[model samples]
Target chain A: MKNTDKSAATARPAPGSCSPGPFSNAKGPDHRGQAFTRPGSGQCMKRNSILDAAARTFCRDGFTGTSIDLIAAEAGVSRQTIYNHYRDKEMLFGAVVDEIIGRMNAVLYGILATFPEKPDNLEADLVLFATRLGKNCMCNQDGEFLRKLIQAEGERYPELFAIWRENGPARVWSAIAARLARLAHCGALDIDDPDLAARQFMALINTDLQFCGMLGEKPTEKQIEDGARNGVRTFLRAFASRGNPSTKADPAVKPNMALF
Target chain B: MKNTDKSAATARPAPGSCSPGPFSNAKGPDHRGQAFTRPGSGQCMKRNSILDAAARTFCRDGFTGTSIDLIAAEAGVSRQTIYNHYRDKEMLFGAVVDEIIGRMNAVLYGILATFPEKPDNLEADLVLFATRLGKNCMCNQDGEFLRKLIQAEGERYPELFAIWRENGPARVWSAIAARLARLAHCGALDIDDPDLAARQFMALINTDLQFCGMLGEKPTEKQIEDGARNGVRTFLRAFASRGNPSTKADPAVKPNMALF
Candidate 1:
């Protein structure tokens, strides 16, 4: 199962080909004499590849069924290489969980940052925000992998999930809630509980997508757009401050009125 | 593994006894002349016990990990008895899915029937309705079982989940949509899309509970009530018609005003 070239193994750098050594500056030449751009970067690339392979394997096979060998094969690395990075299967799984959670949190916060801090049009801006959220956070590979992992293994590893909850949903919700509170403070919304509103906001955005995801189907762009549009409309209707006359009145009556 | 005849099992009839036969009225004796009340009820009793055991095992172990023997052991029935009813493990899983879906559908429709046709106080009525929905449909055993099954095995058995989608969410959404449409027609709500409203309605109610459920923790009655109360308030805010004088103004401002 070892794929490292025999010649390359003999000519390995002092740090070892798969070892993540801080001083490894130049990725030593492979058996084919192809030199990697940097020393440490090659090891980082291999580590990332292993994580990607592990995520796919875990999502597909679940925790109990996934074997380290399967992941090694999928990553095109030797089992020893994987063990060199992660001590065991459980440790690898934990790393995978951390990688996924960290990536999702980054993506979620990135999307949250774009949430109309100063919107010219509340409904339109919200729709755009929600759509980006759907595409960047929910419909993406990281989102799908993390969701499947949580569903498949949440019960088996409660401590891991507790950390996930803290870093994932809890933090995301608070960040969004802060944004909503800012909007409400600006007299754009009348939300009483920014936290609850944030939760409801996500829930509404996911209404259609959640059902599709449950059946293991990725939602289409059109479906995502429609869900966002409808969700934002209802959300605006519910929270738009009475002082914002353009949105305070039912948008259904004057649908074209822009609320800047 | 068979504990069907320990003193604990015999004394378990009040809640644990698996007997479901109508004729086995007394639940008194076993075939050893322990005076089981009646005849013919044993078959029905055995069937229900098997289903209950199957649901629990399937939800806990997932589809691939679960086996007929595990279910049989859990149900305290022989493997032959299980085969007598279910042709195989897949068939038994199908039966469990069917049983859960049927029971949940019945309960959902029963609660749907209690939706206020013409509410004098829309917010209060909706809170009560939402609370009942959370309690009877979502937090119950059948709902939990169905959710876990759908999440764990929906991808492997697409056809099963397709049917589930049609019979479960689709039907439920349409039913709630019809109710919302009726309220809109009565000028109590300004809903443009009853379908979207219905989806959002359920989504909001499940926000907190969904988070807890993901972490494998059951939400308390207080949590459920809070979710429902908050969800209904937001729902009403979004949909209550401008012409409905009682709800046209912000309810928070006049918190004590009784629209009823």
Candidate 2:
């Protein structure tokens, strides 16, 4: 919002996207039930392509602002082709959100399984877990897209998005809490309330990256790593077992942390 | 995005706004230089009515959606009357943002000043400080509006939002960092890298309230207080000096924290 609009419109660098290296969601792909379709099926591919385009467009523009014509152009299909798969614009949008939500939840649970139930190294393992979350679930295409759509359109379509937040993130937080409870059960950490600790852990991880995301900039892998490391370190300081020498705090020592 | 308009439309709840209580600015009002205007100036009041209308409309319907006609209607003024004060829509938007940004920054610093320089009771003092931040800065009208505008339109007008971010939040974070540094220096907390600690502190304060805000729900005073208490308790657990008995962690004690 400015007067005169003097900005010499320079090209904005497309935000970075990092494919997770060490983390893999190997729990069978296509959580949205497209898995049954044979890869060679033309119909399945066409459906997937339309959904992808819809997702991209909806994310860039709010639901009201997006049109079926825009989605068809984006998918490189005729508007008639789009109509063939989905009944109408509303249906198309639902399919996009549903597909991404399914994929997002699947990826989350997949990564949750990677949580170190028995960590040989507490600090490193926690950092690694946080990194996996950032790279795979939070910073990934589905995560970013859903977040944008919700923030932009939640007020307009509250109930529609309500399904999303409840089914996905609401349960997701509880799931994360359960995992922390497991850690506390084994005396790896000293968390009092697993739910509260879980929430803090999540918030801490975002502390380093929240600003960049709010500005629509994708974080680099280095940033994801640095953020993970810093967040995990603080988390350990807060909840690590006092008896555990590995994570024992030495307030005087400012150790240079590197994520391998 | 969803399919089939089968769901009956429901009117959206207009989001709540809280006038921050127990934390008055008190340091001469109107950070946007409206303080200099003599009270009851028709021109100044008219200008502000237009700005308030513009801010409300722009936030509700993003920059592209908002028009001079809409703002004029919202302000109860003739379109020409709005133009008389500001050059155009762009100019009006700028004035609205600038006024809010200035007010936001001032509120932030004013709250920051209340950070306990010497706390006889560390936990209580920190909770009080965090509550002040939440009520006065984050969840208030100016704070919520600017955040919505930035998120909705930052990409379209990257340069415009960039100034708000850099001037308001960037400096605000470092300013928070300085406060934490002072706290650490006084031996109340054990922190390395005040900047990192500062960011964590901000993130922690946001933890309990983030989800509600994302869903476009305004947090109640109770929620803000609960959030501050939970966040401060964790912050102390991570950084409070071991000698500080009030905030010292007890691995077995999951005390029900209460905020005064």
Candidate 3:
């Protein structure tokens, strides 16, 4: 859909267009300044455009299933133009991954920035973040594409999986872990290992929510939401430091007679 | 090395001995104990041989890269026999997956059977099970073979993924959940939802112990074991039905729960 609108606008032959090629009109000496007046901005825009097209194409046809010709056709650019931007097929795949990771980070961080000061508000915000992340991860179009991309080349191009780990799940996980750790330290929450805690929190969401649905089953929106809510509540109960510390003594801190 | 030894055994051609075929001269038609034998045991054995060969070839060369000839040769059977057993490439792939799932179940069940007692022995037994399962999941030849098999066919034959989930993880998970639920009912443990708890437990083991190393990072034996221990302990802490119940007393419980 995004592709169609952009392509329709770019499809117009310019006012005095001689050729249809993207470069043909922009190449001549008279049109050099007109072509890239804001060169840096244009470059970023073009790169993103290519990445969007690449994502759609890869999502549809898979890595081995897709070709450069298809990506170029979808992007409304010449094959040469694509090469000018990306080194090869593998490199282009890496770029597509990078763009997705960047978009996800942007969305998640935006949600993070909106986190409220009150604990109740923070829980609400975190749940919102989780919902958005899950939606993205399990979207029919994007999810299928990601599954193909990761499952197909994971063995041959193991580094791609590692890069995905570093960029996608791990990045968000670490951020969440850090926040949980800070909360724990501040006596706002109670956790021994934030990393492990974060993973369990995620595991709870995943169990009844997305993993089965990803296989083939379609779960209701209410079911997914209810599961997420239950998961967060359960996690917080196990980790929250809001309870009376005097009620249960720490098993490890028993009778420090020497200090006394 | 197994292949080398087997191939070396087959390399020698003798007049009285049949060369590398399903039947050897040493074993003739069964005259005795026919009633005890399964009706299609001969065909089943032959089918299994082909599947074993297909698994080996697929692991080494991937689905697209492996050929029927290689599979046939490795199985010590003719190409026609393989084709007769499996109608097409996809069927052969499916058969291979079926065999792998069959083998995994056998191993997993065998291990689980060793400790039939309930409650106290379970934790120790679980540690042993994790060690074995982790080795199966993340170490050595069979693990690599399984990884390659899943990676190669997961996208192309996603139903294969379903089979894996159903036969492998889902089956084991449900069994564990039921066991834990029984323990909880007996007042030995505490848990609200056994299903969710089971998923959290498996995910904990998978993420902390096996997943990273399985994807290609080199983790030592000690590291894997340590990670597994920590994951299991954390999971137990999260879901163990102990002093605290899933009541309104949990301060972490939010009024508005967000479902992802």
Candidate 4:
């Protein structure tokens, strides 16, 4: 599976920045078994640097516009080394996409772990959870790049898209929904279809940020916060249990916008 | 302006299918004045035929991956004819982008006019409106292509993205918000920020449909309807006036999913 490599990160790889666990020629998840593992930490770091630079160049210039030379210059490495690591730009892009998808997957679960099973402050907790998902997962530089590349190259490369199909947003939505189901069991929210509720929750959060994402601009921390805060509020208005659905609650009163 | 060319289509251009209106070599809105217009309806159709084929090919292949020879074969025109209209692949790609963006714009306004100004059946009216918006504007072939191109080319083509900045979803959100405001004015709904409500409305409806979009799959009509119906329901749950916020209504009880 494409996600098989995420386990190699010995460090609790930070949510948004999942380091390339082990470099591989695994173009698609279907052939992941054939991927040869890299040796040595020095080589691992070097591979990560190349992947990072490739991600940046690809996001900026597009798959066609990007070059091994461009990535090599950005990574401060020789083009031959890049070729030695990844056979071509397509292989490199597949690897880059795999890395980001893994990072975003980590980001999703990391935030999900903090979901409020029991909550005294439902709005605050939900907003915080949504904000972390937005900032660390959706609005981050890698998130921006992943989205850009996905929109740009959806038709041409299915193998490159293996990460999403195998370990993608569908899983993220269901994961979040499972948590919402747990919350619903606790009588914290009124939800009939946890799956639909989960999708809507994400949709609400993404509403405001979609424009910046479309234009390939990174939203300010403020914009991400506002989107999450407002989106979560809308989510609550629809799903919160009776007596808790305070539609008129002041948005400014919630001062806690911290990591969950 | 990129939107300025959309006006040339005097045939009451249908939403989500704006024709080239008039072909011009306008690479970006900045140099629109330099664009030489194609002469005569015959040539206009030929140019549009080439654009249509190019759009398909570009979506199928990335900008660099696509060749003039491939587009000529698809359009059934000589390669020289393709060059006769657009100077290069970049110019051709820009024209294709312009056509789709224009179509999406038409789609947006066409659906916006259907918004429930004053509704006797608010739920039915809003759901129908949202469904049409989803089906006609968002999930159609052109809409899918527009999103893919936007996400794919956000960084490399700022001038090519002039349609969005000059006339884009920002307006769509505000325009939808204005309709919601009118509904609120009539006490058919309860909305505080029309802009936020409009955005959330869009976000909610898109929740279910985002998956197909990500994978570049064209959602079935049923999928589009389900998304819009469920999304509008969630929207109503949050914003429907206190007397009208019926979250438990049967999903199948409503039979009408028609145009506004």
Candidate 5:
């Protein structure tokens, strides 16, 4: 079987094995001298390791300078194994990008799930939410790697990055916008455009962090927390509904309310 | 005289020239069998062309992949000429970065000068200001080239990029903050921290434009204009002083003034 296609079949026991019991698929030798266990686990492990090593190398050396042999060496795999999984360097690079994007999207959706659906205190909840988004999404390894790769090679591989543009920022913005729309619908925010507000919210959170992030400096937890608090405060200042009496009194003092 | 050092001296006319008049420094043969003209004009032209060529090559091929011979060839100069102008490839890279940063700073300061110091209409003035900022500073060739270089090579040369951090975003933020503080002092804005406000202001402007800019897509003038108007409206909504009655009535309608 081709190495790439072996991972497609569901995990199944060897044919004519022990009555299809729960332990039948357990990882051990079966009757027919084959291991009855997860299908393609070894191949998948090798693929993931190669992707991880490729990401590190690509981020450090950039695309034009990187070589498949270098990637194979870094990945501790043979050259034949790499070619077995990936057709070429370009395909390998695309796979690395796709893997990072997929991983980051999962983290992002996790952060988005924590958006304050029923915010008891809008500013405080937002600070927590923004903090999570910054730490877990923007400042994480995957995010930094993908950002650097795109900035470095986006011009060279416009089509590859267009996929990123669609799946990364476009989807992230839509999800955030939906949350803001719900908040506006609930009379918490007087937003004219949730789409713009979502973008502005991220912009505010990233303002102080942009230079540090660009230089690949990992921000302290305190820095992330302060940025989030400050960003959410500005956002609330601009969009808090006039009818929201709690925020109407004095907006500046609201964000400092023992949240950190 | 070394070609590089010849540009270091201030522009001056040849000594013992005819009457030392304005035309004495004009481009023509003078005393001492040498051309008497703007002292640094030729050197400056050569230096600019070298930097321009270096920037293009470094951005395309990256630092490691680029060579002095390649840059010299692209710039239509000899390898010895490059060595004469810059000590080595690293020095040439630094010069290219410095030139782009210097050019961008001039454009940025020019944009900062147009801040709504005395806004007859705050939203309209801000829209115009923001449009200028995006079109001139962020979207320009110098800005794009510098940004890509930094993202790609910032980690490779921390000290070099540290200089950029100090002069680039740091100086830009301070300049913008000074303007915002002045506006706040004049009761135009209700900003407690002009620094954060300045950062947030940029963030808002970059909200919609980030993806396109990162992907190396040049935004249309209309796109820039709309982004500015929308970004400024959100900024003003957050920071406009309570006493600014014009903005207080209906924030949505305030920004649509016929400034464009």
Candidate 6:
């Protein structure tokens, strides 16, 4: 069975699990898996450690719902350490958004990397791509974290919406658009405007799958996989250029725009 | 010149203005050149008047920004009248959303009616149709109101999104999809999934024009009209199976999909 354990620090095995080498001392018991920890002076490392803990806590509880004392206690540090890093609650909340968006991008990019640069079969390529996207969107706890972050920040800090637009969806859109453009250029697909095509494909997936998942109705893993395959099939059929011996071909179809 | 006047009610008939007819009597005296007078006396008439005013106010100010008192004053009715009609703020908001959506649909349908049902020149038909749509999105205040409504209510009330999905964009999509399907059936266009093509066309317009307008950084009206025309042009060239003899001669390549 697949492990769904969420403790980010220890989600993977010890360094020895793969093949322990010269860096084994770094993976010692005091490692604690804290991202903020540094090798030199312990003071700065301790400050970041508190910030990391605060982020996890705020992800679970909202800005108003969480207290500095709780964050301090969870981080195994004093409340003064958190105050040293962040001036107040608002500042801390901003930090949390930054951290969440960064983590989400990392996870998304990791999944997207699974697809080949150019695949032999269009259908197989699309199915593989969509399946990965669907799985990450639904099963990943970080997806919930991003959703809750948007919901909470949208209420209090409206500017976070603009930040999210720039970093989150906009970034993802550009990445997808580039991939589509590459495919269109290689004659894998007959697309006049790659960016527009990419947006439509995304809308199809989000409308059919992600939106439903956001409604608190979780589909099984098999269901997600199947749904992705179907979506890709529909998309490819709509976009593929059918070779037909027909009448006058007014061939003025332009290539993908360079604006993206 | 386009009329830029803003009058609630007025006399001295404005040139280049369509007669609102009965609704004109309900407006203020400045534009129509008349004194303020109540048209009907019954409770139902009075209730409808209040609703009209509330709808106008909700269009101007958002749901949270508006209040019972402003609505009452605008309708020339007491606050008790509003309470009598709507149970609470949420009910009033829902009614306003419905009213605005109705008006939007009316405008879009009116524009569609101006075009021939089946134009001999499909390119000209699409250009004209898209020009009209671009005008509504870029040149009118309705687009701004729509963006606000979507941004404000999209989170708390998914029903609002559903309404737009089902009635506004969805209807337009189905209209285009049906046309594509008919063309495919007649072997005029090489399409497998007309619905997906329709969605893709809509997505092109939305991302290129609607998104810019919503962001309040829109290009000039002429730019929008031209952009939309180009979008339709590219879409047709890419999807229409009209004169590609090479595509039909290939036995190895499957024609996209055979759903249509």
Distance from true position, residue A35, model 4, in Å?
31
Candidate 1 interface CA RMSD, Å: 2.3
* Tens digits of per-residue lDDT for model 6, B1-260: 21123111211123112222122235662322122235545654555555566655654455555688887777677776566656666776775565556557778777755543453566567667777876874345555456555544455577755666466665765677787787667665676557656655654444445334322244566556655655555555556565743222212111211110
Error of 2 at A242 (Å): 0.7
Candidate 4: tens digits of C-alpha lDDT, residues B29-88? 231222224345465566665676677767666677678887776665678767666666
**Per-residue C-alpha lDDT of model 1 across residues B141-198, encoded as one tens digit per residue:** 7777777677667777777667667777777777889999998998888888677788
Compose the digit string of candidate 1's lDDT tens values, residues A1-260: 54445323433122223443221233321322223223455656667556767777787777776788887766666777787776668877887777666667767778778888874577778889999989977887777777777767787787776776677766767788898999898888888778778888988788778866654667888778777877787788888877575374433322211210
- DockQ of each candidate, alpha-carbon based: 0.42, 0.34, 0.16, 0.46, 0.44, 0.06
| Regions of candidate 1 where Cα sits further than 4 Å from its true position | A1-47, A67-73, A76-85, A243-260, B1-43, B78-81, B243-260
RMSD of 3: 14.5
Give model 3's DockQ, 2 decimals. Answer: 0.16
Give one digit per residue, the lDDT tens place, for model 6 in A157-217: 6675566556655566567778878877776676655655665565544433432343334
* CAPRI-style docking class of model 3 based on DockQ: incorrect
Task: Look at candidate 5 and tell me the lDDT of residue B182.
Answer: 88
Q: What lDDT tens digits, residue by residue, belong to model 3 across residues B153-192?
A: 5556776667665666566667777877886787656676
Candidate 2, residue B227: lDDT: 84
TM-score of chain B of 4: 0.77
Q: How would you encode candidate 2's per-residue C-alpha lDDT over B128-246 as one tens digit per residue? A: 99999899878887877877777666776776667677777667678778877888888878888887887788898888778666546788888888888888888888888887876
- Which has the greatest DockQ? 4
Tell me, per candidate, how large a share of the native contacts it keeps.
0.65, 0.56, 0.19, 0.67, 0.76, 0.03
Worst 10 residues of 4 chain B by lDDT: B251-260
